[model samples]
Target chain A: MIQFDQVTKRYSGGVEALKNLSFSIDSGEMVFLAGHSGAGKSTLLKLISGLERATSGSVMVSGHNLSKLRGSQLPFVRQHIGVVFQDHKILFDRNVFDNVMLPLDIIGFDRREAARRVRAALDKVGLLGKEKVMPIRLSGGEQQRLCIARAVVHRPAILIADEPSANLDRAYALDIMELFKSFHQVGVTVLISAHDETLMEDYGRRILRLKEGQFTA
Target chain B: MKHYLFLHWQSARTALAKILRQPVGSLLSLAMLSIAMALPLSLYLTVMSIQDWVGKLTQTPQITLFMEQSAETADIAAVSSALKTHPRVKGYTFISKKQALTDLEKRNGLNGLTEGLDGNPLPDAFVVTPASLEPKQLELLQKELSGLPMVEEAQFDASWAKRLYGMVDLGKHLTVFLALALSVALVLITHNTIRMQILARRDEIEVSKLIGATDSFIRRPFLYHALWQGLLAGLVAWGLTAWLIAVANPAIAEFAQLYNERVELRGLSPLELALVLGCAVLLATLGARLAADHHLRRVSAN
Candidate 1:
């Protein structure tokens, strides 16, 4: 579950990204945050991820007030959540399997168990046989899928993806949306931020649209 | 607990793999650290060897008491007996003024310089060997002997020992200064290397942070990389010092032979070698930690 009670995030030099915005999402609820380029979608996700604190009010994730969370507590808070960035931050220095193994490795899952889970996660994202292949050799959609595999490898309770299909084609974008839906079907609470309004029409899930840092509907 | 051990083992294995992947870069970093460590270690060992050789002289220090020229024969005999009865005196050989002149005349070119003098210019003296070879105790003996009646001056004539002491003191101070400077150099070198590594892997680190990686988890591989670099560099420095001593030993032995002095060339002792290796690892670890902290914080802040 995530809650933002009158949250305000203002960067330095008086740039207020989010101003007194309030929202809440219950457990097992898959919702999409829709906003334009300069909207506060990424800022909202960062606040929930403990990467950035709300400038004024509280942002709570899984019953913990993130503003009050100390630096030492951030890692523990983050362990229950998985985040996917827009840039598809897959490490090319190693193979695809190692990239997907990052989350499980961070959480100290047993090797055999981690390998099994990694393969399972990869299989879910349709990258099962590309384990040993370098990430740079993967196509754009495959790379995005690899990021999804890495995010879900540890089976986090809450998954937040920022622009997961930002630069991909319509088919690739739909594929990524379908991957999020699959995780959502398994009772994983998902929050995906995207600017495209038409993509969410067929999902039939709740959409929280923000226009200039305030919910439009 | 088993999972924890497995995680550490995996991190260590990954660290080694990362190092092996960049063979040239890793080797270059190790060589730089090794040369930095070896230069100071070589100087320190050289100074220690010099101190060791000086320590082996084994001759007890001597004090010479020169009697006043106008002193009477009875006063001279009294001083001689006093020197003989002193507890610290191992032996005393009296040198009369005539014997002193005779010995001076036996030099390379001044055979008859004192032949036509009206009287013997040299005073009666006694070369008294102290039972203690310690410079402090010998100095104390010289002070006590100078207080005796009819003794003009009592002094130590071990000028070579004094010169050696001065040089050794200077060498010791220089070694300390050099050690401090080079240790800082080593830390900075390691810091720069780790900084570069962090910068190169900035994206990976950010992704790891996003995926719930703790700071320690993110830092493990870099720390191990630093540790490996330190260990390899320590070994290289050890080898370099040994090689330097080996290359210089024959010449040193030949020089010592000309002086009819027994000298043995020695490298670092076991304890000292351990110290060098341990300090190398420690400095490098500290450097790596500092760099990692700075860069990781920067990445997380972004």
Candidate 2:
């Protein structure tokens, strides 16, 4: 579950990225954050993931207050939330399997368990045979799928994708959305930030729109 | 703890693999670090060997006893017999006034003139050599020898030996100071290298952090990179020092022989080698930690 109450993010340069944004997503719910380039969509995901602090509001993700969390406790909170970026953030030097295993390794999973989970996650993303292939060798669609596989390999309670379909073609973007929908069907809370109106229109899930720095439901 | 260690090892392995991808760069960095570490260490080994040589040379026991000119033959005999009977005294020679005059004349080219003298002008003396001449024991022996009833004065002529010892002491202190300064420089060098690496890989770190990787998890690989760099550097330094010593040993031996002194150049002792390695590892780890913490904090803030 993720909740934000009047969240505002103001940079020291007098720029406000998000202003008075209030939203909540219940457990296992699939939601889309739609906005323009600077409409606070990425900032909202960052706040939920505890990657950025809110300037003047409360942010609660899985019962932990984002603003008050100590440095040492940040990792524990992070372990419960999975994040995927639009850039297909896969380590190109490593094979697809190892790249997917990154999240499990970060969470300190046992070796045998990590192997099992990596295989299962890769399988779910339809990348089973490509485990040993380097990420650079994969197509753009597959690379995005690998990033998705990596984010969910640890079975985190919540999954946040920041512009997950921004760089992909329509076909690949639709495939990724379906993948997110499947993850949500399995009772994993999913939040996606995107400017693709057509993609959001097809899904017909709860949509929160943003303009400038304000959020409107 | 076991889990943490396992994760750390995995991260380290990944880092090693990544470095292996750029073998030339890794090797060059290692070579640079090794050369930096070995310079002062070789100097320290040479100084230690010199100290050991001086120590061995100063082990011989020798003392001088001076007596008054008014002392009689019986007093001289009593002093000689007492010295001969002393447990620490290995040998004693009575230098009578005539023998002393003869020795002085031979040295100063006054032999013929001294032989024409009417009477002996030199006083009675004794040359006593002890079985052991450790510094503290030699001082004690000097005190006891001066306490003899017939002995008017006892001198140990330890000035030359003391000066040698002082030089060795000063050398050790200087080595420590120099080693510390160089170690600090080594830390700076490592820090700069890692900082460059962090700058190059900024995007990777940001993505990792954004995806729920903890600071320590992200830092582990860099830490391992630093550790391996340090270890390889230490080995390199050791090899360089050995090579330099080998090249210089023959010339050093020849020079010592010219001065009528047989000195052996010593290699690093086990403790010294261990210390060098430990210091190298410490500096590298410290540098990596500093760079990672600084860059990671900034990136997280951004």
Which lDDT value does model 2 have at A85? 76
Clashing pairs for model 1 are none
- Chain B TM-scores across candidates: 0.79, 0.77
Clashing pairs in 2: none
lDDT of 2 by residue, A99-127 (tens): 88877777888889889999999999999
Question: How much RMSD separates candidate 2 from the native structure?
Answer: 4.9
For each candidate, how many residue pairs have backbone atoms clashing (under 3 Å)? 0, 0
In DockQ, how does model 1 score against the reference complex? 0.54
Native contacts kept (model 2): 0.46
Off by over 4 Å in 1: A167-169, B1-9, B63-83, B92-127, B132-157
User: lDDT of each structure?
Assistant: 0.88, 0.84
Docking category of candidate 2: acceptable
Error of 2 at B284 (Å): 1.9
Question: Candidate 1, residues A101-177: lDDT per residue as tens digits?
Answer: 88888888877899999999999999999999999899988998998898889999999999987888888899889
